[model samples]
Target: MPSSWLAALEDEASKVLPAVFFEYFRQGSGDSVASTDAAAAWDRYRLVPRVLNDVRDVDLTGSFLGTPASLPIGVAPTTLQRAADPAGEAAMARACAGSGVPMVLSSNASTPFAEVAATGVRWWLQAYLPEERLLAVPMLEAAVASGAGAIVLTVDTPVVAAKRDGDGPSALTQVPPEWLRVNLGDAADAPKARDLGVRDIAWLRELTGLPVVVKGVLHPEDALRAADAGAAAVWVSNHGGRQLARAASTAGCLPGVVEALGGAVEVYVDGGVRDPMSALSALALGADGIFLGRSPLFALSVGGEDGVRRLFSEYADGLTEALRLAGSADVGDVRGLEVREF
Candidate 1:
């Protein structure tokens, strides 16, 4: 297996994928402070392991949103998967299915919902509201028909970030027409970032019987509001630090956000979480599950479906080892483990 997603797979993907496309994944907004700091924030925490806990057989399996997941990690919603391989989201779907995990398909997926959902993997749809209500409705309908079990409604990107740094137009614009047209078709469904408050989340719940998750929440107040608005889960993220330049890392704010929710709803987080120990720390702090953004795509880019499967297997193994070393018997035992600032 590859040493680490960053050290091996992503580095190899940089060479395999187009230079501009690779930059799109590599570059973060402004000074890239939040993106770079997310992992460092995790490093600041020191794990205090308990002894003689009998952790000989660590179990990584757990339930996510009522579904069985072999690991406490899930692939995050990312755009333009076809850029990595022609198989696109379909490849990822099969990979996740084989690995016994769920995948959140991006609203901007180049492949149609039906194609990816056909893989029979437990899947969720991540959507951004377009300016037109008509566009949003049909996409939701399609996701349901395609067998999506949940809806992750992103609420943070109310507008394009002014500090976003990158050269030239989005590589997405240059993508082949077939590859650029979001699964919703070419009817100008490009989401016009706009404000969405608690009411909108409530409306979504009424509209879809499927579990609704509010993503991109950084504040405990917003998380509480999400719970009030009927969100089944709250995804704590700063958009991988791409949305806000210096926003607090998800790890730094997770404890506060989780405390605010007070377990009113399941809480998940993403941002600067790339490896197993980082994942274990988040679980200990209170995240129900962890998400991987750029790393999975890098895996797909370097070795397609096989690479992704390998990545998931490696993560599960690494996490199991982390649990054992921390004297945890299983995923559940990880919660409330002793941890403090370094």
Candidate 2:
């Protein structure tokens, strides 16, 4: 693996990819403030370490929604991964499976569900609920047929957000034909996109035996409501600031969501998590798991599956050192670390 940082990988990807695909991964919605600030917000909190606490043998092992992972991190779903490399979602699955981590496959993924599932990684299917029940049902059937362990309903994204200049034409021209087909059959049969409500959570839960997770929730009450509505988990996210500009950062919203749920259901968070330190801080603040969106895509662009693996390997190493410094032995010990906000 190359000894390069994520920023360097971003630079490398920029040089190789088309301007459209490059901008798709590089820029967030509306001035990119929410996306940029979400990552920068991690710096606002300082870690105050405890000394001489016998921090030997730090453990990174953890479980999400009853699935064990080598680390407490999971890959957040991103679209058009094939744009980064031909292997696309398939490469991501192999990387996560090799590292014993979980990955959520995006509904908009370039590769079909069965092909990616063939990698044998523990994965969850992320879906956008269409207004038409006919369209939504078939999508769920595809996920079930692929053996997805869970279904994550992205309640955010009622309609596509306004893209920054250059995102549309570039994505349309550069993206592969197969990449646009999300494994669900017949574009003509597709349903209109609509808003998701708490009742939909129950409706989805009744249809499939798999556990249902509500994603894109930022409010504490909404998190609690998801749990009440039969959701197995609540994922706190701001859609990587791709939907709404100037939205609150996921990191900022995490604590309240965690506090509100009070362990009734597992809680996961994503948005601007660039490295291990930020990931560790999220665990300390009560998130059961954290997800990486842009970083993994950037890594994929630089080296395909190998690049993605290297990124996870780097995170594991960084987290081990961070655990020792924070005087924590494992994922469980992370919550006790001293965290202060400026």
Candidate 3:
């Protein structure tokens, strides 16, 4: 409803990006829920608006594990950014750097981490760990050297999700022949992808000094385990509605993880978040931070860095409105929101 260039980027991306990328965000795991999860999670309450309390300037700046963010939100790890533009991660990094937003770089990305990092990327490396030490070891070390402020270790794919179709062998046939090989070596879960994901994170903590956050946690118990295992933060996510359909909403999962952390570690979330309403709803449900997935990819598909800026600004404005409407003036004030218990 709020007008901004972000809607324009989504419109342009609809025209340029491949059908699959658009479809990826169109459908989500939360659609299966019979009721509006937002209604159950939060009251449709307006922030008893104040007429003139002299609230002129709004600050969108914040930090994610000590890394600066132009806004409280930042880009989540989406597979390949280069699919959208030649600069890809480089453009994203520079743009986020310019905006003071932290850009989390994907290990599966098309652009090398070094290139993005060179542009002063506030990079948070995301990886899937392997059982083998040799493979995981080097990647963790490299992330530190790459100037990543933190490491987000993905643990959900203990094996990849079981999709209804084309997820198996059929997926290979889907790639166009013209698609160039920018992959590190091969597809994920190979000897390399797995190795770097698993134990290397441990080494990264012991060796590189970059704080590691465990991604893909959905249950409170797992969040507890991750914190015990040296995770500075735990992200409750289902892979941007792509990995699994009809899974629990990340918003639903956030409360438990936040409690499990007991304020010892940060609890962040990503999933089924398509707007600022959902954004504020998530924070209301007790998430220390929120991560946006498909939105950024679609933004990249349309206009690269400019598209990202537009989308992010839209989110910031949305949050501002949500805050104002909800009667909260800042991200911190969102804690007292009345949640509808089911």
* lDDT value, candidate 2, whole model: 0.85
Ranking by TM-score: 2, 1, 3
lDDT of candidate 1 over 69-187, digit per residue (tens): 99988999988788888898999999999999889998878888889888988889997877665567777888888899999999888776654436567776668876655666633
Candidates 2 and 3, the one with greater TM-score: 2
Where does candidate 1 stray beyond 4 Å? 1-6, 162-169, 186-193
Q: Highest lDDT among the candidates is held by which one?
A: 2
Clashes of each: 0, 0, 15
Q: Write the per-residue lDDT of candidate 3 for residues 1-342, one digit (tens) a residue.
A: 445554465577778866554544343333424122422343342333334443345555556886556677888987546657667778888877776777777776767668888888677888765555455556666667778888888876654543333233332234443232333333344543433333444665887687988888888887887788788888888675445555566666787788777878888887656677777777777777778777777777877888778777788888887676666666765766765544
Residues 1-342 of candidate 2 have per-residue lDDT tens digits of 223585477788898887788888877787778888997887778888877787778889988998779999999999889888888999999999998899999887888889988998999988887777566677788889889999998987887677675525757566556667667555324664676788888887788788998999999998988999999999999899988888899989998998898889999999978878898889999989998888889888888999899999999988898888787878788887778998
Where is model 3 more than 4 Å wrong at Cα? 1-12, 20-54, 162-201
lDDT rank order: 2, 1, 3
* TM-score per model over all chains: 0.95, 0.95, 0.82
Could you give the C-alpha RMSD of every candidate to the true structure, in order shown? Answer: 2.0, 2.1, 4.2
Q: How far in Å is the alpha carbon of 220 misplaced in model 2?
A: 1.0
Backbone collision tally, model 3: 15
Would you give me the overall lDDT of model 1? 0.84
